[model samples]
Target: MPADDFSLRKIAIPAYGPTLLYGLATGAILPVIALSARGLGATVALAALVITLTGVGSLLTNVPATIVTTRFGEKWALVAASAWCALAMVLAASVPVLWVFAVAVFMVGMAGSVFGLARQSYLTEAVPVYFRARALSTLGGVNRIGVFIGPFAAAGAISLFGTAGAYWVGAAAAVGAGILSLQVPDLAVRSPGAGAAVSAPDAGPAPTVRSILRSHARVFRTIGIGVLLIAAVRATRQAVIPLWGQHIGLDPTATALIYGLSGAIDMLIFYPAGKAMDTWGRRSVAVPCMLIMGLGLGLLPLASEATGLLLAALLIGFGNGIGSGIVMTLGADFSPSPGRPQFLGIWRLLADIGTMAGPGILSGVTAAASLSAGIGATAVLGLLGAVVLWTWVPGRKAAVGSITG
Candidate 1:
């Protein structure tokens, strides 16, 4: 079959249901996580630490997660991960101690890494080159949709019960996601270095983490390093936006409204971005995404008025939307066919490190200088990410078929 004949519906529809549920589950908990910590009688500093544990937990799981993915395929791994997430949510709800709830959230994050890497690995295996971006971008879009709608669902649940009711929403989403995970098509993965996909039921004794790492060293050093910066910029954008809003003296409601609008704009363009990446090139998406986001954040500190802040926020959202699945898309593009899970485990670990550090970078800078200086520093890092992509990441034509792995 022709590569163009690869159906977006086939790649995307399978992921659509499960990812949405996962997104909802996580989203419902995110906004109120700190609140939950405080209600458990934790201090403000401890509550903040509670929120930080997720990224830390994700970092701790690469080895075990790789082992699980190696033994079980992506589909089974996702099901297991989602189920773990549901259990974690239930555990979180049951816990009275702040530390226990923190551990539960951390478990959820670790499970998320497995679930995420599995889906990415499966997509890399199943989707052809031409349709890859669209499929992955649509997955990102679906996730954004869930996040957008989840808070409202939590609001209803909260009104009927309480903040704890949101935990049930999270639990339900994980359960639903696990059930949906069972339905995903198990596309046969090809061996690393193979030109085309194959059944690979006996893909030669499944490779080890050490071997996969040594083989993909160049990619990890080059593209992998670049994505870390991308992740940092993305995380910094999230952290800085709210702080920036407050710096400009916007009310909480206005800040949320502006941010929400930006997110909506971001969600609306994922398909077009995927099309551009697949048809034109990865550079088309990556460069503009980084550049636009960098500029938006840099300009945000200069905006004193509500309208100006809104424009900057909207622009940043547009950039973020364009980059919907750019990281996963790049990972898929670079992955060794048979050992995707292992590579992705390490890949995600590195990226999450950047994400975990982004807030610290901003706070440190702001403490040392001013908010504008902090934002400028973050913006420079974002642009620097764009530069890294332009220099290191392959262009559209060159990117295709460049990696024998």
Candidate 2:
């Protein structure tokens, strides 16, 4: 297809339909993983530990996922990963053994890594630069929309089945996602101006993953640092709000309502954020996102009343909402064609590390000092991310060189 003829609406079903199903599968299962582990006779701490296995699985499988995506192509990778995840969900649902359940959870995480990378790599190739941020941001938005609705579906399923009903729902969604993946077309989209896409089927053999990392070391060391900090800040959003709500003595129901409200606000801003990125520049949104989130976190300790907490939470949510696909958009911005999958693998790994570290940082600080201190520390990371992004994420004239150079 000619680049000019392409529009995001043209491929919406093929591009995002599978993602929504996959997200629903994930969302349905995540809320109940701990409950399932507990039912299988895991201790509280062990059940908690089992939850971490998802992140661990994604961390371990990232680079390998790149190899898989490259070897089989994005469409097949998505299909295989969806099928694998469905089986894993079935195992989780049917298994009475704790260890087996843990293994199934880990497999789901591994599948997630592959599924995530494949879709991201595909979108990076299929969309043009002018529409890139909007495409990716919408991708993020739809995933969030799926997740937002997943728990309600899980609740209905649980009423019909049992505690494992969520797993069954996830399994069904995964199968649906796999079916949808078969419809994604293989497009040969242009790079920035005149270059061919790196991952085109007819292209020559790409560089080894190690060599690609070696070549992109500076990119990783510099802007990659900013990416990590951004992920870390983003990760803390869920934890900080509820923890602070509890600290201030709000009841569980009220706390949940507040959290849901924030999430609702967070879901509403993806398109406007993407439009801002395409119109003004990445920094136009990136810096303000971090700044607002940082300010919100910094203000958390002062929120003694529910109203105060709600306001602070809304601020943080708005900040996060505007940054829905900033990470993926940035990854797409800098990726090289021949090694795009590998580079994105490394990109996702950095993000995963940040995601894990965010909570750890908060916990360590809270344990040693106070909840207020831990939140303050995370707020600092957000500000640091803002500064780093302002320095590295180029404006319009330099946009073409933002990451590719």
Candidate 3:
């Protein structure tokens, strides 16, 4: 395939359409889950616990999702995952009991794990090395766009048909995604011999999951640790912005507006960030991303009003935006083709752990000290992440180049 012929535009619809819908489904349901649990007569703490199960489901399913994708191929796995998510959303909407609703939410998360891995794996194989970062960055950005649109869609549904209407919106989105997944061409069949340069001579037997883990232990320990910290800081930003907005007595509407504005800034930068990575190198973006976020968080506690909060939030958003696909791009760069799915599974598991840990760190610190202290702790982690990335993540020269064979 000519480099020019395989541009992002060529694969835009097939590559990004399902991600948009899947992201929409997830975004629509997230805000309403707690409300639905409360409506089902759960206590505040229980409702919170129910919400946590979504992450738990994703965390537990990471490795297993890779197995499904490896066995079924990306297209079929995506289709199946979308169907599973839609069914889970229906159950979430219809369940009378809180536990069943929680289970349904968990199932939604599990399906998400499968869907996410399938798409990432697909992009890794389908795009050439030279275009990998841009492809994955756009994938991340599209998902963000879907998520950004989701809440408004959910609000309309809620107003028209009550809270349950949100779940139906999610179900509709999932079904849409599944239908689109069918349209994504089978890239595997199209170019079976494309990446032979990187392929090894035939080994006696296919590598098992355990052996793959053992083989890549060095990667999992070094660059993988940076991935964990990156995820942690990112999750902390998501949690801190709203909490601090409220802490400074901003109204919910004002806080939401600031948050939305920040997200707008975030969405605008994904492509440029990706292009820079493809050109300058991953380190060029990754290190600066973490640095800016860390600084933003460190300064967040000084914001006592809406304007200050907006500035701080935008800074954080800018930082996050520039590093949009860093994690997935890194995974693709380091993944060995024969066991790529397995490697990415472990990669995602580390990221998920960091995601869960960020919130826990904030909550734990706030409980013991103060909210400012919690934010400060996360700020420190963000800087630490930058340092780790600088230490472990290789430059573009080391990671990718145009194929000449």
Candidate 4:
């Protein structure tokens, strides 16, 4: 509970181990799946649909998953989610038909929604308020580590065993993560007047899912807007970067390296940024970071070579690293209940929606105009969002000592 006790290695490893594995599997298989879908007689748009469908599934299940966790417990929900994800991965690897694979991906997304909501909610409750930023940073760092490693591993797997083989590896990893989830202790929701020794309240007449949505309307709306902006930024890059890389004569490996290098930079800065958030306040970091992200996105179209691309990657990585912790910390700070899983579900739903829409929208824009135009539009949107955040969100000066309570 001490302020200094929230070091990255100390808090992050335990909370993020299962998540790391999940991310590893997700990141590793993404490129391989897209390429394979195309190779397997699917069109370019159909190949992309695999990714979009997954996000759609996540958006659909986010709220339901949260309700399930609130009714059950975070630990149980996580275990179930992990198991489901593992099963989905197995189906993805084994199924030969494209539609079947799409279904599997969708199920994986649903499982991801549950797992993400539960894991985030658990961290919010388990970590001390003063250390929230550090904890979130640690989580982000580990998640990025998985991203850094997953692609290379997947690429290697593809070379050795082929695309299906890569998916098999992903399946194994998911199952391993599910096994690990069983070991994590269930975090209790903190309640006023209750000592740390108290157990969670027994499940009662559960609120209808609709009631839960209505209850958290304001929080959901704010989170939805922010997540949409973030998603747009990410989507633009995901959709355009590959084409841009091809345009610049970079191979797939080089493309992967760009993302990996960016992830590495992200890992390096995440912890420090988290610490700064706790000390300096969330808004102080988030607003500027968002604008910086916009700048980085805008610069990407101008990059002509490896070095230029790398520089763009670094700027984007650092900017995103700063904002990621702030958003997670804010979610925890503003949750309407100690039942953090429910709130996380709503929060994640918004994010999933943005992610689902981002790639498609960016792709359309690029088709209509150019990659530069798409990236420019995303950058402008990011800048607008940053301005709104600065004006609307509570500032550091107002919340400076608020965590001390």
Q: Largest lDDT belongs to which candidate?
A: 2
Q: TM-score of every model?
A: 0.94, 0.96, 0.95, 0.87
Deviation in Å, model 1, residue 203 alpha carbon = 8.1
Residue clash pairs of candidate 3: none
For residues 1-405, what per-residue lDDT tens digits would candidate 4 score against the true structure?
333544435545457888888888787787677876776678998997786767888889987897778877777787888788778777877777888888888888898888888777777766766677777777767777775677777777778877887677777777777777777765443441111111234355444546546665664565447656776676565545566677688888998788767766767888888888878877777787779888988888999987787788778878877776666676676663444566567667666667766666666787899878877787887797687667555666664323211
The per-model lDDT (C-alpha) reads 0.82, 0.88, 0.87, 0.71
Name every residue pair that clashes in candidate 2: 198-337, 198-338
For candidate 4, the 10 contiguous residues with the lowest summed lDDT are 192-201
How are the candidates ranked when ordered by TM-score, highest leading?
Answer: 2, 3, 1, 4
Local distance difference test, candidate 3: 0.87
Compared with the true structure, model 2 gives a TM-score of: 0.96
lDDT of 3 by residue, 114-232 (tens): 99888988888788767778888999999999998888889988999899999999999999999999987786442313322243434556756787788778878888899999999
Q: What tens-digit string does per-residue lDDT give for candidate 2 at 224-330?
A: 88889989998888899999999989999999999999999999999999999988877788889999999999998999999999999999999999998999988
Which is the winner by lDDT between candidate 1 and candidate 2?
2
- The RMSD of every model to the true structure, in order and in angstroms, is 2.5, 2.1, 2.7, 4.0
Better of 2 and 3 by lDDT: 2
